[model samples]
Target: MDNLRLNLGCGGTHHPDWVNIDFAPRQPGVLGYDLGREIPFPDDTFATVYHSHLLEHLPKRAALPFLRECFRVLRPGGVLRLAVPDLEGIARAYLTAVDAVARGEADADARHAWMVVEMVDQLARHVSGGEMLAYWRQKPLPAQDFVLARLGAEARLAIASAGSAPLPPDPAAASALEIGTFRRSGECHLWMYDRFSLLRLLQEAGFVAAEPVAASFSAIPDFGRFGLDVEPDGNTRKPDSLFMEARKPDAPAVSGPRVVQVCMQHTGGAGSAAARLQQGLSAIGVPSFLYVSSSAGHIPGVAVIPAASGQTLLREDDGRTLTHSQWPAFVQANRATLARHTHRPPGLELFSESETAARLSDIPAMELAQIINLHWIGGTADICRDTAFLKGRPIVWTLHDMHPFTGGCHYAGSCRAFEQHCGNCPQLGSTDANDLSRAQWVRKMTAYRELDITLVCPSRWLAGEARKSRLFRKKPVHVIPNGVPTDVFRPLQRAPIRNHLGIGPDDFVMLFGADALTNRRKGFAELRAALERLRADNAVSGILLLTFGSNTGPDPASLPCRSLNLGRLSTPEELALAYNAADCLLAPSLEDNLPNVVLEAMACGLPVAGFATGGVPDMVEDGRPGRLAPTGDIEALARCIAALRDLSPQDRALSRLHCRETVLTRFSLPAQARAYADLYRQLLEARR
Candidate 1:
């Protein structure tokens, strides 16, 4: 926390407690800066920004933009207090002086004379110090106390200096250039402001709750400590100033950098991870909005993109969208690309090259987002098709898989084609170098070339793979593991929960979960083979498998052991229960990014027995937290599972402690949010 307060054009009101800034820079420790230039600070860096008697120095045309600059630097809900010479107060004082003069009060003419000079001299003055300086030097000053009361400490000091300093450079002898230079030297007020007009000005600059306050009144804590407007003796420093404060609103702007995350849905691994990241950001004082394909329930700051009901015309110049009546034809037309792959192999990973109908601009929050976060936006090709909507916004795209870099495939598997140009893709079953995969790779890479996207991978394996690809080889890459809610996923009373789930206290239960068990990438086939081997070995007994997720895949009952299918554990509580009831999580994914199941289970104090693929090595190594074997090796996988089952009571508990500690220190959502907050600031600090 470098001082979270900013003082613009501090002049003589410099404070050690504030980040004092002045155009003149005569004061020590004050940053010499001009209001017209962009402030060399990240967005929402300060909690409060203050400037005294500085606004009137700016030309009327530049005033609103200058206020907007104040808004940009102040955090949301932060205070922006400014002091300017009040025109209304001057006029009322002038009228009161007139009434006093009419009543023939002593020094009434003196009071009126000072008022006229105050109101007109600042605007019409040409020479430095002007007529007001001459009045200060008057031998028997007209209304001397009234002038002190009106002008405060600055005038008293100016008056004291007038007697000691010798005047030079007669105005009559000055050249045209000398006079021009004097006018721009900030000796005169370029504009005036009243409370009423200032309120409107603040509102136009995107600030709310604008109102006038006393010199001693402010939302800033210990504002008087700075002694900018009031001295310790309780006398005003600049009594003619009117103080006002306005709040920087919580809009698309950042107090913590408003984040807009784009995800396809809010379920499954990618969607759930995206939603959790949003919650993480919110928990860390960053306001985040989620743009999903479709939202189910009402969640604050979560918005849905309109579902595509119409088809896009294939013809470039056609400019026609299909109607509901054309659903049959639309479906047929969409199948045209995949129709060529009629001989495509089955039992493999899912391949999608389809371009989504909804564009990134379709999300209404796009125009307002200060920082755009892209996550698992598969099928939403329009997000990258023409990234003109994302212009001027710092973008962070989280790599859920290889989808962001590869051609039409989430995982390139053994194909190194993405390292060059994706074509003749094994996943897409393409033979031609100029196939659909290459065309899509070209399309996506061309769009990416125009964007300054920073890629974030949850797994080091994914990041390394992303670097190998031509699409992201030049992009800045970061490894940020998917965060788990430690509070929700912490270890629970195991024996009681195990009894409730009909598992014996002595049973060796292993948990398994995924969107689908039949998905080849999940390595369910290998897990099943390994489980059969474990059942045959008398060394491992009391085998009980607790599985959750869609029932569409192969039945868990076919595991050659007792099994329970907790079909679709939709809530964190359900997932936590599954983690609690198990001795360890069985993750058999042959190819994947950092799986959310592994992170969640580990957070719940459950070790993992899985293949050493993707980011698994990052989490576990030879029972450090869990046991891992070479990927896709059934015998090695079975050995890993057996190693977990044979652990002594004390060893098992120690392993659980390791799992919990690993998640608490590395994978907690708060830590994830803080990392992202810092990264966002870094991006904004070096904004393109």
Candidate 2:
């Protein structure tokens, strides 16, 4: 076997033993030529190439070339170990937690984790004065870190002090369940992936032997500690994480052009949309370069470029700064950029070379893929313009909120100002909001003019807003609503499911789906106030408030309302059952593009009640499938719930039928997948 063990794109975290290659000299591994050019290794030089969370950031055009190069460089029978976040698994994890919470069987740790996350976010916001960008970028202040450390340490101590669960006599069966249970806690996950898409990308990239392997790690200390069976000498660590291993059988290594995927925003809400999208694409068919900022952690299919030593500044084409050692990589990257440019518009041809290279140095340019750009947060419009990553691609931007258009506010708060170049900002209480809005509008217009991108609005309301915006007025805009698979979110008819969960059949369950609690936008506080009012009312007797997504909230169990944090779901089926069990899904979001939970709940045949703002009007027709309250009307919300409780059986049945049909007809997972696939194919054809 060849002795070469390659750590592809290893950064500060690279193992001391491996031969590492990275663009940043500051990275713990070896500094090498830019990854954009052909790799320096000889044909069949290495026996193994290990890449973890490194591929999703590359431009789509360079993906094929990078894979071809990987194959050429690998010896026959050589193994390439690749790790990316598993999309399907994450989706399933999302569903399972929601299901568990609905059934009222939430574990303690799961609940605590949610609380910790909320607390941390709250502290972060308090310190940063509520600026989304500043809040996200702000590292924990000293006091905040001290508090976080104390909290984390306390939690760790408690967990360590808690005795493990006693294993069942049949260890095998119980082990499976325990493992399954641990796997279902996906609150920590924000993205999803799977083997089908991953394998396709590997195969397309020239790998002949590509297969997925089961891998996991135990968060629990030991099976023996939990009174479970242990092999005499077997490793005790639980293994649940997943990865792909691919190999090339033939081809001589060639130093070809290189490509890099740069991830701009890594932490917090700033680029969460981009992160989630990249996570989705990791498993999808494409092999590209990933270059992420130092602050960001591991993402499957991405390569974290280390910062080079101050000594090695290499001035490249378009005046972009890079390390001397990264020159070859830059050349390769430039070539890959050119290959992608072949599919772009004519006027864009003028500055393709400089435009492509300029991005790697800055944050905005890193995660640019050929067909899509996961533009993050509100302020990225400038980065979008300067980097020109949108030049040839169909940029599918998922606005976490409307901040980009509402003069730098995440929620427009009933402001029509955004419709016509946003002036007289309602949120800012200033007329100059229009001036700021027009500047952004001009920036967006400039971007729209250059790229063959599509403005993807998760909600119909957002899509309508886009139409009103001067920037997207002439662009191709589509409202592809988010979906949760009905299979995972179906009604649970099993008696034990209810009985084991300890939820009373007669209990009036008032439910809410959660995200960031500090984000007044999602309306958790309003939900809290409304629930309190219902408690004060005699009509609210036997009411149970259920919230998921955000773990931190008023104690559901203490209020005699069961709380469960299923964390993030790994499958859709798990979510369906939760939806089915709910009496009502609360979506009192002050402002939303579109809430997926509403659609998921309706699909599961449950009635929804929430504020009738954003794209929500597009989903609920007021008591047809679900009820919509006036935006921020706590009393109206309480009244609506009381009314829903009093509805006749026949009316409830009709409502359920309507809800199911609406989702099936318009928002089924299959329908969305097919639509996306069709769009992909169309883009391909247009490129040709």
Candidate 3:
């Protein structure tokens, strides 16, 4: 089969050098085939398999089995090339058109119509002949002219020739015959794909190397002989198609070392970030394991190892399970230390001076891993005590909040005491130079002084803060923003989502939430003041405020708008739907790293309006996605919200598209995984 090449679902395109197969024998030499069933070819029968815009025509359930069949039929080291319409590129182009229309750079009517056609016409256009043709025939002259403008010279000439020649008798009967042929043509797209989902699917189907390539670019020898990739004028058949290739491995490949991610609890914002990273790493062929103290529920693909069993340790060292019988004493010591801080703030953090629980290094998964990633190890683990045991291993500490660098406070708020040295702690209401906060700071500094550790901050703002901290000032800090699964949190129909949320079609919906709404750092009071200002100024009416998170704040009736309290949506799916149900997300955080709410909302195609604090400006691009007011400026915040409300429909649509594109381009899960993979490789190389 050295000279053999297979072109499945070739449609009307044919090549003499390749076995062109399609469900319908569209050409004289084409072989009749159906991709829904297994191919008739023997194992390892072809040197290369090429298919363009074919896989999406099959049902979603048939995608994997069909790909596995392709892998089965290909010879060792053989290539599989595919080209599918790029959903991301299409969405981005639609956004561009919407922006142009909003700016008056393009005619709104024509551009909007073109965008709608580009988005769904391929899927909705009937394969049975005259449905699309009939619709086009009924369009006005200007609309028909616009369609002709998008066609190539050859296609235009063909259309002109056909128009001049066709004056057939019984045109209705002729159309009926053509429609019958078209009904059997198998030309509808059943499923869609973007680069990330397609890459994961290819890897799952057993392709050793799957990567996207430029259109008309291939590694196959004499690939152009098939004439499958390009049009007669040498341009690509579809300009916006995602061209990709995968190779069957010649031999079994060596796998990389497993990643063991340690976090406090497998829930909350930090827990979600860690879990998503683990999922992403696993999808990209890295073995990932997660060890947590407690879990909200079962997490898929992560092996959750509980660090403690009540007061007993669960770790095994030297084949002996270490039991923390003195854990009760340690808890009492922790309470005594916390009791010293008499003036606790609304949201207070207190850490034990020392940890007497199971050492993380003694865990089986930790011992087996090549890398130890620490994330938000507050109540579950101790950095001062546990990190000392990880002297020789590569440790990657991901800062979820300020706790890692600060003196036990989750956020410093207006306190810059952690920058120079933790002393006269305000959060703990201590005037002593060596308070509990200072002691914790000193312990952490001494414990991690010689450990091999690299710090990863999810936002530039957080990284900057870490660089200022005394404990992590000299540590290697890398800024890697948290990622969201765009596939899961993608844009959904707003009308249905809003209807499901019991919101009126004309109401302006705004989302405000966090882990705890009453937490001072979350700025719920500021949001309430801004809403009141908006109402007093009569800047917005018919407003629906959707507040989520723990119901710890003031009553919803206190707000000036009709309000709904969702009460802490715990899952990403539920959160995604909530994001889609709203027009914009309001994040009035006084202090934050990279808030996941912004990323989640943007991924769901919801604009964000908030203060220009922390990493808010990094995610929300002022006028593009939404407006950002100066920090703590309630009136300015109110005006920003009103501005978003007053935006034209086209501009709002543009903002929604831009928000989704921001996540798709920068904060995708695959991008985060790839960044970590690079960092891991670097760390491993340095260790050697």
Candidate 4:
């Protein structure tokens, strides 16, 4: 009896015994067209459908649709078998080798395992929870004996020399080679992850029940005895390679509320979000913790589990700390850090002096309410070894910048190296700048793929960039602009501010600052040129150019005007006065992420004139309260300055009122807080 079995995405490797199919019809015995375009077959056409090594290559936009197609074509009680590389298996193999290498028993298999670990680590850089495993799939088929043998010359020389140990594996080496590094049965495999993340992705993809099809029967007796059950399938006659059986139920499953823990390096952006979220949960009474690195002191309300408090204190210096847990994740994260750091100690110790970090908890399938990830894993290659941290959590990443996405640069202004995968960073003067380190952005991206996480970008520009990133492409992304406390920056009547700043009524002040005068990205050069053009205009008079920053000499010596260097004013009120006293504010930045000063300037009723770069447009209204020059155009900037000089007192006053109103309506703290509240409620309800 033909049970109506099928093979999907068969590029030329169709099983002769089954109803074979291919997206490309040119192949022989092609049964259908593109899996993404449409499912050509009828509903319940096959009782069992199988896919091998084809899932990861599909762009995220098409993955879910393909899954639905597969489901549509299956019988009610039919099985859908998906055979992909097991990230958990590879991660386990890599970790075992890492453990052995640490113990000083680095054999050929151990060395090969370490190299794979390095590759996984490199891919995990810059991302949070499950990103690293998205485009790449991990499989723990037998290592290529031929490749393992090739390590002999490189492996033997290092082993023979006692004083000269082998150079550690290059984490970014995979990025240097094309995708197909080691092909197994015609499939090109890229990365591997742990069990937790893989399971999370399956569940998130609408799979009702995802059961791991064990390959334990083929495992060595020693490995098989290590708490893994060996089961044999009579029909397939082969060990299922990390396959899973998932179904879409008629109705969704209900999950309970959970406790989420967020650990980060510091108390800024990421940690602050965690803190705010905890406060939100506290309002409704959900358990949450925001943990930060401490030099010595602990935050009052936050539960401070000191690194010194952990069972194993790995490294302790330079604002870094790693501790062990009752389980493996914390240990792996720390052990990797210790090994990497100890092998190459720097001028300063990297760990914090006050506390020890904790390890991953032993619990499996944690009903975590949410995950907040903001730790900067540095440019070392050990973060991949610590995938257990996200085992049972639904992650939420607040990407402040592209640092974790692009090999550790706070700003990836012109570098697209991260687009392919980072290594040999040109910024680092390294040949493999494009490589993402195990502890760098690539690894973070890889790890982000495996978690059921929602990604949050603080600025629209950042959010857009995150969409282009390989790690964040699959996740639900939201953009929530940063907010400011408007009451703090409220406008003071101009007369008193002018009096306090000792400015006469007749003084026409042109204000600019919050940037080094010599920096190119700030458009200081254009400011100087515009000032010269303003000074030369016969209609303008008594112009006092008030600048706040380093009084680097003007870029253009031709500009003739009285210049004041307020030089980094400390007080906000003082800044407010400067804004109020000025006839206009000038900003000419090349790139910005919702700069606070622009909003502050508007809130203080100062007219702004600048380039339309980044989030500056969200703040400046072209010809209303202020003028925005064409991006990078100095001539247009000069015209805006002249226009401001011509504005009547009543018109200027109206512009100021409009500017203030824009902030109150769109960018105030209350509005921002409300948006977040709505988002949180919506997300929570969806899960329910």
Candidate 5:
């Protein structure tokens, strides 16, 4: 502990004198560790430590414990140095620029714009890079000298490298939700800190004599020689950062309260939303756990619930004759009844209950959780039976659809029975007053009636639906849009992806995706009609249709254009490839709660042409990035698709940027996570 050094969250800087660790290391020998998590080192191990530009990414609640962790791993008399964006300095600059702008000074307007982005972008950016990145990458960058003065060497190097480097092969295509997860995994700033807050945090973390230092003047022995904070040109590595140092004071560390996000599959909208919330919470210093019916467990802090009776259950519809373990006798009995009762009209949208209840409440993680959030729990949790386990906890349920508030329907498409008592169910073609839908509704009422639960819906339409439901009409409902990682699903060079896909540069490629395109609500029928209209108009000659996901009814080749169906794009890179190669995405779903495709496509700078129904209006602004037609209006949809395809090159480029901007500002994972964290805090306070 006397002479050893540690560099935590070391992005690119490395020294032979120090042990380097980062969440995403850019160099060899730099350990990859989640920065806000517990440090993997013995107590009193290092003589000196440093972390740069990391403190602000942590939520204020988590910063103290993280500092305390640094204090604990550090030896007595050792020094801990940290650098963060100088909030006070930025505010002062912002004010000065405002005054200059008011006086109509030269470059003041540009300076003020940058100052505003500097103040707001990182904190508010839902997508990776956000508005600041957009600003930096602008051609003939605005206010170049003023920007360079504030951003210093780092920005210059990035801008220089970007300008000089050829557009290389994109290696970013990786995961389905890769874009929305960036800031939560440590790229975005969660909370800003000034000199005062910095000192207070260090002191609270059990440090002593916490004081400011210039990058060239660290208290660490011979620190100026290392060039860790200061560059060879004598310019600070991060000019806007406030560098500070404090002593260990022989202290220790611990962490804050815990949370668990309970949800269904990890692949769909609800699961992805729940997973992102957990990620956001984890980033901000809360190690929020995820409890799911089943998962790949790729996410940190995820706990896949054990199968029923310790045996993996093969879940199938009522006609299924095989499984690894037979579902519970009662479950099988219920499935048989549900099958017999469903003598309804065909073409209804459904991917019915996938799993039987697993007593996840008995798990250790559940017991340790101070709060439990439920999302898309259909078929996974027995709402009525699981009430006993869920009752004592602070419960939050996020509606992925109308399922939670309705009688067994994930979407009550054209069915308003849920608003009443669900009698005379049209889904079942039953006219009986005491039909199965009514029975299920009664059970839901009994389960939810007295339970203390808060509800969240991702779209305003869904929020209104939940509020209108008899079951949740009295429950508190909040609207928080879904978040997707923008980094993975970002703008890519169209030429390379098109060439690789054997597509001519002049071809108009329209992409469409969904769980199962055969689902009537996914609007494949409507989409086909629109495509046929384009064919009749001779607009399909240069068009290539790209479709993904399972299609059991009609093959994609049956569409009106030359078609390629890349069934179920399995990787983030693959999705990125599809997005980059396309002229526009056709999200023709008639009913959806903020479909991930719209968000992901926008994030990738691919405009979306879809029906202006459900949450589509929330995403697609006609003539901005994409256009929307009246739902079921094939002529209007064809016109809308053509409108997106026919944009002038200049307008198209701006639309692409605007598409990315829309998601970055509205549906970032961190923002959703912050909102949930705030809600959780309020609930916890009430619980206490």
Candidate 6:
């Protein structure tokens, strides 16, 4: 008998050699069925299964189970070929256009117009009618009209020709035709895919080997005969589609443990640390994967798995920014639970009662990982609720803050309720014995009962805090300061950097930065007070305070010192330059767990001055590389700043060398990675 082949979600495209299936079959001989539901075929039935622009239509929760069903039905060595629109490609195109406009290589108006079209046109266009196109022509955005006005007559003609056949002259008739087409077509994209995410999903579905393939290429025998790979005109149906092919193996088995590093986002302090660790592990001949909720750039030598996608932009109201794979209804329910707290803080908090997203436990990478190294997964991960998934796994949670041990609060300001049992939490402003904080603590207790978690603190202060926590009192905690790329942040000629920023060599520059400078925990108010004191005392005459970060606090003109606000720098290179240009780095954080800013600043040979709070003293040695004042002592902080300024040229030079050497010896990337690697091996061996 001829090999049985399947073409799932085939839409209007029918293949004679394959059983073409679609939820809405418009053509003859095509089988109609919901692809979200289980496949009806018996086990090991088909020699091949294929789908194009189909997987993204299913909700994230159903995607993997559907794939598993496909795996169950495929015969040994059967090929599964998939084609989906690439989110990364679209983002790249949008960013490229923006960059071109910034570089003056393209007209700003026209480029911006093209960028919006490139980002949204394909995803938001009317599926079966020309209504969207007509609406665009009638009321175009400024950028859109600019692009259209610049298009040549032939290009306009081609666009007109490509549009649907002329609508009926009667408005009612045209509306009917459009509605009819819409009813017959499957229109909305529920998710988006990039190469890394798609490949990871394929592996999760039990495919032994999966790799990207060209649109015209297929491993399946006589694939072209079915006319399924391309359109009737011999061009690809979706030009920018990402095609991947995977094959089933003869037997299924659990692979040996590898390293999977999980983080909330692939940026910021936590993200950078996780990425560096993965790179370090890879350098030492260990396989590593970095899984993030969202990412804009691909890390070299690390397989980056972004759970979210560009399609998220279309579903902004869904509240899935942190947990993209979650169901909309579940997100709503979770948000409702958070809303019950009348005094909840402004930022994100996950209080979901249940898990309704694609579980990481289902991913093959997680299954193969001997040790799941977690870093700053707060918004994207639910440790209390996801316990079932992590029950048997060995977990190494690197605490970037107090959130892991506390009741949803990233830092427990002065609340010691966590030392025993979290209740009447101050952060939540709840006095009830069974308030959200207490409930969360209870859930954590239950979840962690069977979990083998080794808590890693980047500072001694955080480790001590973890020991004081009721949840982690019995668990082992280790101090492992986060590492930085010393070479990248090494000392550069100060004068050149100052020249680049248009700063005078005579000016004494002080730098301050945070993800959000206005955040109360960052203590910008204290910095303000210290600056005022410095100005009053005339501590240093040519003083200039420079700030860089999102939402930098207050107006610069209001500050006592001459100030410059470099708002929200995008790259590490810019940050490094800023550090090099500065004479001293100011870190007035009220509470923190080994701030990466301090490390980067020190690595750049810049001394830091701040209150001797959590992790500050650990990095800033007293009377050496930098000075630290009493916590919350604005006057002392001002004095420390003055002391740093008063140092002679020779003493300052020695301090700079000391700062760089300290980072090189203690916080280098390889040292951090080696420590984690040893811990991983120990855990794996203990399990054996």
Question: Highest lDDT among the candidates is held by which one?
Answer: 1
- Candidate 4: residue 230 Cα off by (Å): 52
What's the distance in Å from true for residue 149, model 1? 60
> Tens digits of per-residue lDDT for model 1 on 1-688?
5337888888777877777766656656665434443343445668889998888877798799788878876877889999999999999999999999999999999999999999998887778777787787778887999999999988888888886656534678888888876766777788999999999999999999999999988888889888888899988788998899999887554377767787866667887898889889988788677766544443444544432223221211222221112223434554676667866666665566636666666432245467889897654436565578765568899989887787788877777888899888776567888988888899888888888799889999999999888989998999988898888999999888988888998999988887777678888889888988977886446888888886653564576777887788767888898899999899899888989889888888899999999988887756689999899899999998898998999999999999999999989899888988899889988964
Q: Model 2 segments beyond 4 Å from truth?
A: 1-370, 375-382, 420-449, 493-501, 516-519, 524-537, 555-581, 630-636, 647-661, 683-688
Given candidate 3, what's the lDDT at residue 225? 60
Candidate 2 per-residue lDDT over residues 98-186, each given as its tens digit: 56667777363353334333333322222211222222233332233322332333233323333342321332344555544333222
Model 4 lowest lDDT segment of ten: 347-356
RMSD of every prediction: 19.9, 22.2, 23.4, 22.4, 21.4, 14.3
lDDT of 2 at 391: 58
- Candidate 3 lDDT by residue in tens digits, 317-360: 33222223344455577788777667765565444444546467
Q: Record all residue pairs in model 6 with backbone atoms less than 3 Å apart, i.e. clashing.
A: none
Per-model TM-score on C-alpha atoms: 0.61, 0.51, 0.60, 0.48, 0.61, 0.65
Clashing residue pairs in all predictions, respectively, total 0, 78, 1, 61, 7, 0
Off by over 4 Å in 4: 1-386, 423-426, 429-439, 515-519, 536-540, 549-560, 569-574
Judged by whole-model lDDT over C-alpha atoms, candidate 2 comes out at 0.53
10 residues in a row with least lDDT, candidate 5: 318-327
Residue 180 CA displacement from its true place in model 3, Å: 62
Each prediction's Cα lDDT score?
0.79, 0.53, 0.74, 0.54, 0.76, 0.73
Cα lDDT for residue 139, candidate 6: 32
lDDT of 4 at 464: 79
Q: What does candidate 3 score in Cα RMSD to the true structure? A: 23.4
TM-score of 1: 0.61
Predicted candidate 6: what Cα RMSD to the true structure? 14.3
Report residue 477 deviation for candidate 5 (angstroms).
Answer: 0.4
